[model samples]
Target: MASNDMIVAIAGGSGFIGAAIARRLAHAGHLVRILTRNPDRVRDRFDFPNVDLFRADVTDPSSLRIPLAGAHAIIDTVQFDGYPVENHRRGLTFERIDFGGTNALLDACDDQRIQRFIYVSGAAADAYSPHPGFRAKGNAERSIRNSGLPFTIFRPSLVYGPGDRVLTMFARILKLSPVFVMPGSGQQKLQPVLVNDLAQCVELALGGRGLNGSFEIGGPDPLTFDALIKLMMEVTKRHRAVVHAPAALMNITGAIAESLPHPIFSRDAATFVLADSLCDNSALLAEFGITLTPASIGLRYLAEGS
Candidate 1:
C-alpha cells in the first residue's frame, strides 16, 4: 500500500470528485485506473503518467472485474445524478447505483482480494432519512462497513471546485439574474469542502494510514447557506439580491419540476438542503493531516471561465 506500489482503481473516476482523486493519486506516482462506462469520453481528460482510463460500469458487476483486477485498492465515488423518479425510469437511481453498485464493487473487491476500499459518501447519509437518495447512500455505506474489508468512508458536504455542477450552476444563475433564489431560509448550515482537499484525504487513506471506519469530512468552517452564496457572488464579482423561500414551498416546487429533462433542483435535494450539513472534521484533520481548504479560497475556481 505504499505510494510507490499503489495501483488504485477508481469507480466513477470521470466525475468531479472521482477525477480529482485520480489526479491526486496519479501525481503521487500511483498507477491510476479510472473505471467508467465510456472510457473514450474521459480518457483525454487525464494526461498524467501511469494513468489509465478503462471501461467499466458499477451496476454491471461483470464489467467491473477487468478494471478492478490487480489493483491494490479501490475508491468508490459513483453516484446517481438525476432525480429519483426520473433516474428510476431510466433504470438508474440511488438504489441501483449507490446500493446495488456498491455491493457489486464490494463483491469484486473480495474476489480480487483488494482489501482497502475508500467510499466517498454524503454527510447527510442516513438509513432512516426521509430523502430516498440519502437512505440509499446509507445502505451503500452499510455494505462497505460490513464487507469486512479495511475501508475508509468519507462523507463530504457540498463539495465544490472548478467545473463542479452545483457551484457552476450557481455562477450561471448569478450571471443571468439580478436576484438569486435562496432555496430555504438561507440559514441552514453547510460545511462545503474543496474538491482537491477531499481528494488529498483519499490519497492519504490509499497509503494505508487510518484506513478503517467512517469519517465525516468538511471544510475549516461551517457557514450558513446565505453566507456561502454571498461569498460565491463576491468571488465571482456579481451583485445580486438574495431572497429566501420557505423550505416547504421550495420542496413543492422542486417536486413539480423534477420531471423536467434537467431540473434546477429536485425534491430530494431541496428537502436535504433544509437541514444542516455540518460535521466535526477533527478526525479528517488529525488522521489525514489535512488542512481543510476554506470556501473563500476554493470558490475562486468557480469564477474561472465564468
Candidate 2:
C-alpha cells in the first residue's frame, strides 16, 4: 500500500458491482481488502496490485475480523442472489444478507472505528414494500442510518455491464427461446445505469462528496422493459419474435416455481421487474460532478463480452 493511500474494505468485493469498485479504488492507489466467505474463489475472479482477498462471511459476524481490521471505510455491496428468497439455504437470503448482515457489519464497523460506510441499495427499496427483497434493502438502509456512522446510501436502478447476469439472461433467452417473453405489457420503466458509473459514485462517497444521506442513481435515459429487450436484441444481432403477457401471469408462474428445489423465476423476481425503477440523477450529477452513462452505449459491452 502507498503511504498516502487509505485502506478501504469492501464487504462483497468479489461481486459484480463490488469487483468494479475494488478495481476502480485499487487503480486509484487505495488498498482494497475483499471480504467474502470464499477468498479463493474471489482470487479466481479478480486480481489486482493493491487488492487483497480475505475470508469474511457477513452472515457469520465472527469471520469479519481480518477484513475489517485497520480499515478506514467500508463499502457494503453484499446481497442475496437467485430467485425465491431462500431464507434458510446456507443461511443466505434477502433477510439474512441484506438486513441481518448489514446490522452485523455496522456493529463491526463501530467496533473497528471505521470512518465511512457506503451502502449500495436498489431504486425501489422501501421498508414497507410488498416485495421481500426490497423490504430487506430498506431495512438495511434504516439500520445504516440509525447506526450513527458517517454514511452514504446509494439506490441505483437496474445496474448493467459486461458480466451482468440480467443482460446475459436476456441474451441466453433470445438465443434459446422461440419467442421473447416480456412481463407486464413490457412497459415497466427502468433507468439502467452502468456498473462502472455506480462504482464511481461509491468512489465519490469515499472521497467525501456524498455523505450522511441517500442519493438516487440511474442512467441518462430511461427505457421500458420492452425497449430494453429490443436494444439487447439489436446489440446481439438477434432477431426473434417478442411476446407480452400480464405481470400477474409471471407472478402466478413464479409462485408455482417457488415450490421447486431450484426455480428459474420467483414471485419476488416478477414483482421486482414489474415495478418501475426510474430515478432522477440530477442530484447525483450536481453533488458529485459525475455524468451518468447512457443505456445504449452501456449495453455495447454485452456484445463484446458475449
lDDT of 2 by residue, 1-306 (tens): 332287999988888889889998999888889987788866977656998899898888888876898899899998665633553445657888888988999988766777789999888889998788889999999999999999999999988886777878888898888799888898889999999999888887788788797999998898999899999888888878998878779889978877877666777878877889988787888889887878778888767755
lDDT of each: 0.84, 0.84
Q: Candidate 2, 59: how far from true, in Å?
A: 0.8
In candidate 1, which residue pairs get closer than 3 Å at backbone N, Cα or C atoms, i.e. clash? none
lDDT of 2 at 215: 91
Q: With candidate 1 superimposed using the best TM-score fit, by how many Å does residue 223's alpha carbon deviate from the native?
A: 0.8
TM-score of 1: 0.94
**What would the per-residue lDDT of candidate 1 be over residues 1-306, giving only the tens digit for each residue?**
556578899998999889988888888899999998888877778977879988989878889888888988999998666533435456767778888889999998876777589999999889787677788889889988898988999998888887688778889999999999897889899999999988888877877666776889888899999999999889989979988898889778878777876665677767776878998898777788878888889898867766
Show where candidate 1 strays beyond 4 Å. Answer: 83-86, 259-265
Q: lDDT for model 2, on a 0 to 1 scale? A: 0.84
Tell me how far the alpha carbon of residue 88 in candidate 2 is from the true structure, in angstroms, after superposition. 4.1
